[model samples]
Target chain A: MQQFKTLKDLPEQDYFTGGSSACAGCGPSMGLKLALKVLGPETIIVNASGCMTLLPLYPNTPLKASWIHNAIENASSTAAGARHGLDMLGNKDMNVVVYAGDGATYDIGLASLSAVAAKNERIIYICYNNQSFGNTGFQWSTATPYGSETKTTPRGKNNPTGTTAVNKDMVKIMGAHRVYAATASLAYPVDFLNKLSRAKERDGFSYIELLGACTAGWNYDPRLTIRISKLAVRCGMWPMYEIENGILTLNKDFSELKPIDEFLKLQGRYRALPQDGVDRLQVLINEHWAELKEYNGQRYV
Target chain B: MKQTLVTGNEAAAWGARLVRPNYIPTFPITPQTECIETLARWSADGELPGTYFDRMESEHSVMSAAVGAAAVGARVFTASSSQGLLLMHEVLYIAAGMRLPIVMATISRGLSAPVTLWSDHNDFLDQRDSGWLMFHAENNQEVLDMMLQAYRIAEDPRVLLPAMVNMDGYVLSFTDEPITIPSPEMVEEFLPEYNPDHTIAKGRPVTVGPPVLDEYTIFRAQNHVAARNALEVMEEVMDDFDRIFDRRYHLVDEFMLDDAELVLVTQGSMSTTAKAAIMEMREEEGIKVGLLRLRVIRPWPAKAIAEALKGAKAVAVIDRNLAPGRGGIMFPEIVETLYHLDRRPLVSSFVVGLGGNPQTEHKVKEITRKLIDDLETGRPRVEWNDL
Candidate 1:
């Protein structure tokens, strides 16, 4: 992971074109842009059907590199084939990357991701966690945080807890396979770029989950996409960490974490969460952070 | 050439081994599991050199991986059956629309609600309009031969579409039959190395499966044109194959149909029984009954089918799979093919061999006798060969 003193030190090449159909202040777009910046032009992107599928609609596409849009749940498997195919063609230098969404990654595509990791396929898989199915008008997905208001988990007059289920820990699941798994955010471009670069340099299966903020889905102002993401990590809602070769390293260490309400109140989805719900969520976050801390700079026994 | 007694599944594996595909992404499914097992064993024994083999989690992943490999300029192969084929249904259209030229072997079997693992065309017929060139093999020999020809047809520049070579589930998949295995040099001359014009490489960038709005119709129309062009391309490939290997193939094979008044149209393994019935009807019964076996169903082979059944008084389509209320699936297709003829033959449907029941020679002869009677009676448009 290389560090740049300034933003201008980054490469000038743009693999992701400007005219994308993504919404304004799209966090996933920024993550994709930065990831591609590190990956450069010698890469083939296997994108699952999601918001990214809409980027290249019809004859027009915003991808400057060779890209394929596969079914929602098979991006990892598709990229595995692409890597093997490229290897068979004697073009081992080309990188095969899977750009997928949370619904495709944490839910329907988890089996494929697990299989790819088990097989140790040489490819980079990036999951843009937008909390819900943003492409289909914000249905409740497994990655959606507890108590988040979604189409399927609407906050009704009778039911106060919008979504009772907690968000799936995909990073830890990938860690179980002992593959290089990391968590990054668009809010921290430099850190995100560093992790993305390191993931690109790895040989076998590598996974990175990027915290992507959705303006319409979360009912947040389009201008605060990066601010909301930063608040998420600052309040201990989303941790910044990496697990490489069974060794876990916490990228952002905070002695005193901010309250969860400061992050929850910023989004409309969590507005109806009761005081008790917030307290319980805070306790869960604290316990999760403590568990993650044990792995900081430690190897799995 | 070496002759070996092997099942259809083993023949399919031999065909793939001879082709030396760069990648094989497959999952095990009943009747088709042996094919993948053979491939895995070959890969372990170092017999499959330079091939990347993976047992995918599901049929969907299998097809997806094959698509990815094909898109990256690799010759790919995969196999599925029954539920497995249905699982891969969605990716089938993508494979053809992208024109990746991946080859798959499907062991025809009945779909499950009752969980029957038997020979039937329900699984194969369900994917009729999936934009893939489909070929049905009558025996293990054709299974081995068609597997080799499928690549040549699919990779043809004029017809860059995915192809499926289908053999009946247990009848061919498990039944042992004598087949000639071609040498590596012979197969090399038959199917030259797959050199794709376009791929997802670093320097060559292309957007595969991009959304198509107003131009969707044109792309679909072009696919139809390409699919139709496969008929000619297949004919040329088969001619070349015959010239090299001395084995002839036809889109629709005819047996004793030159002076017959009744023809029993069949597909898959049932065609062998139909041929035997034709022999018995001609020699012992003194009935001029013939057999018409459909080899390629995708480009429809309407011209060849209609031409073969032109002089016949009536045609009895012995479909091993039923289409529920619509009678035998192939019956209507054959009737539709001969609709514009000046004197169209009367076509009757007979459904048999559902759920792997044997289509015995006696049953086929009964269907032939019914066809002979129907030439004058014109009664019972559809009948089922009762178990």
Candidate 2:
């Protein structure tokens, strides 16, 4: 057992170490670091094929904790197995957390994760939504925003296509399972950590949607990763909220929604949008915010 | 020293009860449901302690919840058949890939569309490459015994892979026979409480299921190799079981194969009929005949099959399931196992008893008798379509 010096005084040896192949200032890396810090040494993680997987399993990497690499679509199931292994060994005090990308969580892994969460199995599932399949070179994902210029969605289209399909409402979808579900952001460390800590204390399945930034794929200045993250929440593009036992609570009250362009302009993935395209994107964002507002819940902002 | 008539399904449940896993996530399905119901009843009666009986919504969820519970370092158990196994197809690969030693009982049933709740090898046969140690039980005794042995084999450090113990639906699963049930205390002595060397439990933390690239598939492959190596441990565990319970089973059981010209290789409940047919041919016709019952299918027990049939002039593999255009599913594996070997015997493939069609004593006799005639005629058909 190691001693904790400060909250960030993490193991001297990181749970997710440096030298990972992740581009500089990847929010998923920092999010993982903070998650391990709070989860302590008594946690096991299940990761999927995304930036998190690429970096962690990169050659000659220094890893402080034990890990299993599962398929992108089955992290929750894999983590569930690890959790059961822990219980078999009489380690009921352990935390089993599965970290997946937006593609894995919102699309392929959606059904299995939903089933496990609905059963309220004791586990933590964190969907690190980088908005696209960054490991595969910025392909548009189900979580990709409208008018975002991804490898597939090269030019932000004014006309609706399949690419314009609404980003899956995973947080609410998971919430509907009556398990603990929350949307968090890497930029909001205090709020993110608080939710993560609370998730750890829960006895059943809990999920936190992490608004992670992919520095390379998103074509952003790595240093502005935190800024991009905060802009997303402030703009109502990525709301900070939690749902516990079917009751939703806003982590950041959206009293005055910021323009979505501020968040869009930070990443090159959304740079192809023309003026009218930005207006359409904002309209969509506004419509989504209206629904968030009408959702009968206590505002925490 | 008491004997009670037990079906393969009952024995599976009895076997699970002996191990006393921490959780059993199960959804009721034909043949396989009894395996979990017995465990649930035991859990309710205090016969099994500290075990969670999760009645999940679907087979997918059953395996999913078991995976989650097992992820937290819990010894988990579940049972399913046919469509249920197919429902868990995705997670089955994940479990093996993640190196979670989750033990599940799969009662073999034909796959669906024209779904029938009858005995067939197609269920587990289709999943042969999913990287799980597949054990086919030939009788109620082996079904019960394999359930106990599967844990030791799957949990072995060399083979930290999930395993499926398969019994033919209705045939062995529903059929009752006298099975010696080991005392829980005795089983605890035989297979101690599962203490995983690597688990993401409370004090000791680890990350399971990280991502791997195509090149890093070697890591996953190595895990599979490790699972294959666990077959040796199965032999040791069975030996230990024999010493304690006085029943014997070869990882691949062979009967009267020495100096034989023809050998019939089969698995699951059909092997019993095959053995009877081989005996009848040997006694009445004076034909040199024998039967090789495959107990372990995942690792394929190629070495055992090869060694047992070494001196035989010809070997015929009787499969209850087809691989479609290719003929018997098990035949190709057996052929591949012996393909590179020096001095291999003539191997014939025959597909029979699909979609729960009974492989009666007559079918086995007809197949083996034909193989004998072909050996004598010197023109044995290596592949035959299902009759």
Candidate 3:
């Protein structure tokens, strides 16, 4: 994985196109490009209706591989078909990748996805979690952080709890399936690409949840997207790790973790928070990081 | 080539074997399960190299695996029956809509709920509009023949759509019949190895599916029309098969429908029984009741069907499966296919023998009498038999 320093270091074939409907500096699109670079072109990508769906257009779908435009709730099943078809054809040297939005993968397509993982179908499924349904206007998604305001979740003084529930732990949910499951950050392209490469080589179901920075939905400056993306991993807000057959392998351990404010203050979605509000978020982040550290340290023994 | 007595299910499995598919994903469903198991055995024996045999959790996953593999440019095969086919409903459309040539064999069985595993066309008939090319076989030989033809037509660059080759469960799948096994060399000549030029290329980059606006969506959807090109390609393949292997399949087969006052429409195994009954009636009382077997269901072939029953006074469609409140499933489709003809013949539908109930030749003979009697008396009410 380290041998490939950049997308340019790999094959000249760029699977994800440069221009599309995705917002400028959208982290998900960049992550998608890097992900495809690792999987290569002998791949069939199944995409649910999302920003990615609209980003790639005719004559120039940001993909250099076979692709299917699946319904929001059926991307997992659609990719399952691609996996099944590939195996039946005696073509063992290719990969099937399914990409979906948080709203699609977590809220709606979860059952279908669970079915695939339970069967352990040979394929790679990626969920680009922007924390909201950005495709059909910014709406609340299961992955939406505890304190966030969207068209659906309007900010009101009385509604102290910005969201009703805690963030859905997709990595943990997928990890429980006993297949390869990992969390990647758009801020860390190399690590994201490395996990994806390993996922491609491994048989059975492998999943990656990418915390992609949504420039439009998050209401952040286009140029600050990468910086904000990087801040997520730096603040220990988004831990980078992998779980292989129930064995947790922490990819990166942030020793001098920055204050959570560095990541949350930058995004307009969370800009309404005051100093005390920010402190509460920091405490929650610390609690999650400690839990992950304990989980990663313990082995089957 | 060595000749063997095999059922339609075995023939389909053997035909699949010749292609040397890489992956065989399937579930254990009646009638179709034998075909999947046969492939599983071949895959396990290493008779075919570099193949992956998957015991899919469900029929949906079976088709899902096929779509995924086909996208990555794998030649794939699978078989399913009534309930399994219905379960795989959504993925079926995705496979065809994506323009992947995934060839599948379906042994038709009645859909469940008072479950019985017997021969019925209701399973495949329900999915007549999923954009996959549909073909029915009246016997074991056609099963083998259509399987080969399906690969040729489906893989054609002009018609990159999935296709289903259907034969009746128990009736054709279990009944032993002498089949003419074409020499592998002849089959190779008739149907070449599937080589898809427009596939996922590692060296170059191209997007296969991207979002399109309204008009472009329709434009992209016109691939369904492009698939219509296979109608002629199917005919040409049949012509070539006749030239080399001495077997010809009419897109729609007709039996004595000409010069007959009453015509009976049926599919799959029932067509075979209807043919026997027509022959028996011709021998006994010389009653002129003929049979029209619909071989191609999708792309309906409306004009061909109308032309086949042009001079007939009445057409009785024996639907072995019900559409619930709507009599027989095929009956309505057959009637709809010829509704535009000026002075169209009286079309009648009968919903009978559901849930795999055996439709004996006596039932067809009884149907012939009812249809003939109704044609003479001009009965206003359509017959709905619950046999």
Candidate 4:
């Protein structure tokens, strides 16, 4: 993997072109730009129906490499097919990647993702986790954190906490299939790029969950996309970790973690949550962090 | 060519093997499972070299993978039936809209309510407007022959569309019949290696199946034009096939339609029983009856149907599947086909043999008798044959 000391040290050329259909301060778009920089133009991307699909509308595309936009829930399987087709065409070294969204990866597309991982298909599956269904007017998704207000889970006068469901543990699910699984955040470009480069070097069924922030869905300031992403990891809401070949490794070990309230107060989705609700969310995050530390054979903080 | 006794499922499997597709993404479903198992076995035993066999998670994924492979310039094949076909219904439109020439074999079976494992046209008829070219086979031979021809018709530049060859589930999928398997060299001569112009590769960076909002209408119109062009392409391929194998197939096979007063329009294996019924009606009862079997359901043979039934006194459409409130599935299609005729014959829809119920010759003769009776009064336009 190529080591980059700073943003200036990265490749000058961009595979993800400019003037995309994404809105201002789109974290997923930034993640895609970085990903294309690492994977290069020799890759064929299979994009499931989501915000990423909306980026390259017909007659206009922002990709310099080959891309296939398919139905909502078949990115992983379609990438598997592209892998097989490339092999049949005697181009075994060409990379096939699936760039999808949180709703597609964690909910609708999980079956296909699991199936491909079971076959150990040589494809990198990346889920741009924006917490909610960002493309469809901010509906609650399986990756949406508890107490977040979405179109489907609007905080009413009687129920001020919005959604009561916790976020699904997708990295652990992929890890259970014995594939290489990792979590990265757009706020940390170096770490994200490093993880992507490492994932590209792996042989089969590599998965990365990129913490993508949605300024429109979360009702945050457009300029605070990277700030909120950083707060998410700093507050232990989104931990950066990797599970390679059944061994867990935490990438970022904060000396003093920020309070979860600092992350929750930044987004309008969690504005209706009471003090107790924030405390409950912090407890859940602490429990998950302790479980990860246990998996790493370290004493719980 | 060598003669082998096999079921329709086996015949379809043999046809796929002869075509030697580069990729096959399939899932197991009843009656269609035999086809997948046979292909898997052949692939495992080294009989099908250079082929990538993908046992997909579901029928939806099966078609999704097939679309992926086909879009990347690979000749792909898959099979399903009934519920599985319904599961793949959404991607069916994707395959056609993307202009991927993926050939699929569907063993036609009844849809569930009270769940049946028998044969019906409901499964195939439900996908009528999905923009896929549909071919209905009567016997094991036609199953084998059409499976090979479908790939050529779909991959034709003028008609780049996905196609499905449908055979009755129990009637043909389980029944054994002697079929002449074509040689590999002959099949290779018929269908050369697939080379797609619009494919996703290293040198060519194409965005396949992109969202086209403003120009979506033009894309849809192009798909319809391609589907209509398939009629000519299908005939041309059948002509070449006839010249090579000495077996001819028409869009609509007519039997004793000349100087006939009554005609029966049918499809699938029921056409054989209708043919037998017409013979008996002509011999014993002196009724001037004939049979018109629809070989291709999509890009319907509207002109040939109008010509065949132009001077008839009445036409009876035997629908093995019902469309609920709308009566028979093909009745309205045939009625619309002959709507422009000056002296149109009386058309009646007869719903029979639904949910895999047997369609015997005796029941078919009863349907013809009902059509003859309707010619006098013309009271009911549609009737249940044995209900």
How accurate locally, in lDDT, is each candidate?
0.89, 0.78, 0.79, 0.89
lDDT of 1 at B22: 91
lDDT of residue B374 for candidate 4: 89
| Model 1 vs truth, CA RMSD | 1.4
lDDT digits (tens) for residues B1-387 of candidate 3: 667899878899888877667667778988777777777787789876756677666787678767766766778888998899998898787777778888889998877776878766778988887889999888888898888888888888888899999998888898889988877788778777677766554443345556556656685567668667878787787888789877777778999887888898888777887888899999998998888998988767777788898888888887777776766777777778778777778877776666667777888888888887777788723565653
Listed per model in order, the count of residue pairs whose N, CA or C atoms clash below 3 Å is: 1, 45, 28, 0
Candidates, ranked, lDDT? 4, 1, 3, 2
Model 2, B50-74: lDDT tens digits are: 7767666667767766766665567
lDDT of 2 by residue, A35-54 (tens): 88777666667777777776
Question: Candidates' interface RMSDs, in order?
Answer: 1.0, 3.7, 3.4, 0.9
Q: DockQ values for all predictions?
A: 0.78, 0.37, 0.42, 0.75
Write down the lDDT that model 3 would get.
0.79
Candidate 1 lDDT tens digits, B81-161: 999999999999999889889999999989888888998999999999999999999999999999999999999999999
Every model's Cα RMSD, please? Answer: 1.4, 4.0, 4.0, 1.7
Q: Give candidate 2 regions above 4 Å deviation.
A: A1-17, A58-63, A84-88, A156-162, A296-301, B27-31, B55-73, B86-99, B112-116, B157-160, B201-203, B207-232, B282-288, B332-346, B382-386
Deviation (Å) of B327 in candidate 1:
2.5
Candidates in order, TM-scores: namely 0.98, 0.88, 0.86, 0.98
Clash list (residue pairs), candidate 1: A58-B211
Q: What is candidate 4's TM-score against the reference?
A: 0.98
Per-residue C-alpha lDDT of model 1 across residues A75-185, encoded as one tens digit per residue: 988888888888987989898989999999999998988999988888998999999988999998899988889999998888788888999888988988989999998
Residue A298's C-alpha lDDT in candidate 1?
A: 91
